[model samples]
Target: MIFSRKIPLYEFFPKEFVDIHSHLLPGIDDGAKSMEESLDLIQGLIQMGFTRLITTPHIYGSVWPNTPEIIRSKAILLQEEIQSRKLPVSLSFAAEYMLDEKFMQYLDTSSLLTIKNKYVLIEFPNFQAPLQLHEILFRLNSMGYEPILAHPERYTYFENVINNIEELKEIGCLFQLNLLSLAKHYGTNVYETAIKLLKAGVIDFVGTDVHRKYHLDTLKKITSKKHLKLLETPFKNNFNLW
Candidate 1:
């Protein structure tokens, strides 16, 4: 569906919505520790009124190393199991790629994980922004992929240099905001930073970024919070998943 760039936020979002970021793929990454746990998490999301989920399993370097093959296989398994149970929620696969040498090498070789294979979801080191990020982003654009920075508000390195977001955007990066950040799940600082981005209209999409039931539980609280009105504002695109 088409989205108007100037549409009000409330007008842009339907009561039911699409959650684009999640880690519900079973036995992958730190989310949904097992198949049973993954099913439980998606069921909870369904209860929360989300109809479509693009679950992004982590593809870190040393820690939660995940490949597209692993992600696709897991996603297919979950799809089959969910169908067998007759659950109605829709699921898709992507990866939250850690910005590292392995990923850079892959990018050079024209291989990377992305949502819909159009936007690559990437995260920087939490403590410091990488020096080569600009070059990497440029290369991604040249390769016909958009880089989506995940949870920009949670990075402490950005606390003093928030304008870096504008620079990233200028360089063709899209930003994905974690809904829990609006509820102070990370901290009051993160919540405030999230609010700033929301008001600025810099966030291109929102996601649960859910790793487990606790996250969904916290999301319930976030859905109730007042500042959620920022998200209630209309998006430019009709991303109404439900």
Candidate 2:
């Protein structure tokens, strides 16, 4: 079933890919354990047609508490090493700002690191949407950052309320769909919700969200040509596609 498509990997990836979500930076959170592992993962990603990887390490306000300075320093070190090793892929850093009280304070001080300092990726709690979401988005906007809600399809509260994501878009937040979700890697419910969001034209960006080898191994078996076709649609022409 995986190779039913005639083109194989050739036309599937007509160009080198741009993956907006990854945890490839070594020893930050639960991603790659060491620099050697990270380099290996980068090489694997390159062979998968990935040209750019925006590595977003988890920045749990109370738990991880990663500052912009630390994130940038790590990113710089890895970027230089990748270049020195002559790897053909690019690496950049952003924080996966888990929503919390301290995150709000970081927004107030404009200290939250983002992709290009324009697009900020945020994650919610697993089971429910916080009541303070609107206020958080308002504060993020006031600080001149566009909040990109990561993996909205995985949220159970929005499982039947897909329009809520659109409401967030109205409030200046974009939705980034996890590519694995489309493959049903999470579950049937999340997969169905992901397709619902995709068809409704609410998804603005798609990301690999690669955290480990198991994630990449799972991706190798995804034969959803429709998912790839949906990704190539006109609705995917968001500004970040570049």
Candidate 3:
């Protein structure tokens, strides 16, 4: 896990990689605050060698309350800006849906938004795992949505119960590890948990999960050999779900 030499961030990433999780949409949740910031973030991603970006904004009910229409509209505006600027990166939109009572309502009404029309990026509370986690995963499968759990390493509740994550995989849930988590941006516990998951070979995709310019800066500085090794996995970034 120790890197004898520091590799530049851009050199670490594969040119074909497509980021499937981010918060680049302006003024929508906790991502970029305006179009200027969004543009800057996109430019950073372009410089980092990302060819396509499926920016996922937050859709938490109590806080964000972002609907599909709202998310799409913001994405359209951002897309127009990118097009006008002639940015090289292709852009799309999805949501990091918070699993709560409101999400259940959306699922019940069949109104949930998905990434690439098939994959749904979801997260639970960071402090504690949801009691109905199993039931929710089963329901998502029954409803025909491929669920990708966001940043499982950041969830402290799963630290001791790593087997819960294995069970989730057995039940068909995919895991997305945050790129910054591998850099220990969140701290040691999260970093170790991410390494554990990567070693287990359960992570299906990697994402920036970017919320601000600081995130992009951190990504540029990451030099963890473990992170580079994990990126060698056959990630689903090119999964033709889109």
TM per prediction: 0.89, 0.90, 0.93
The superposed Cα distance between candidate 1 and the true structure at residue 212, in angstroms, equals: 1.0
lDDT of 2: 0.77
Q: Tell me, by TM-score, which candidate is best.
A: 3
Error of 1 at 199 (Å): 1.3
Better of 1 and 2 by lDDT: 1
Q: Least accurate stretch of 10 residues (summed lDDT) in model 2?
A: 233-242
Q: What TM value does model 2 have?
A: 0.90
The lDDT of each candidate is: 0.78, 0.77, 0.84
**Which runs in model 3 stand beyond 4 Å of their true positions?**
1-5, 234-242
Colliding residue pairs in candidate 1 = 3-236, 3-237, 8-234, 9-233, 9-234, 10-232, 10-233, 10-234, 12-234
* 1 against 2, candidate with superior TM-score: 2
Q: Candidates 1 and 3: which is better by lDDT?
A: 3
Q: Flag clash pairs in model 2.
A: none
Residue 37: error of model 1 in Å? 0.3
Off by over 4 Å in 1: 1-16, 223-225, 232-242
Question: What digit string (tens of lDDT, one per residue) describes model 3 on residues 1-242?
Answer: 98677776557566567788999999988999999999999998888888888999999987998889999999999999999999998898889999888888899885667887678999998677777888998999988888999998888867464688888899989888898887789999888888888888878888889899899898888874546666677344544434
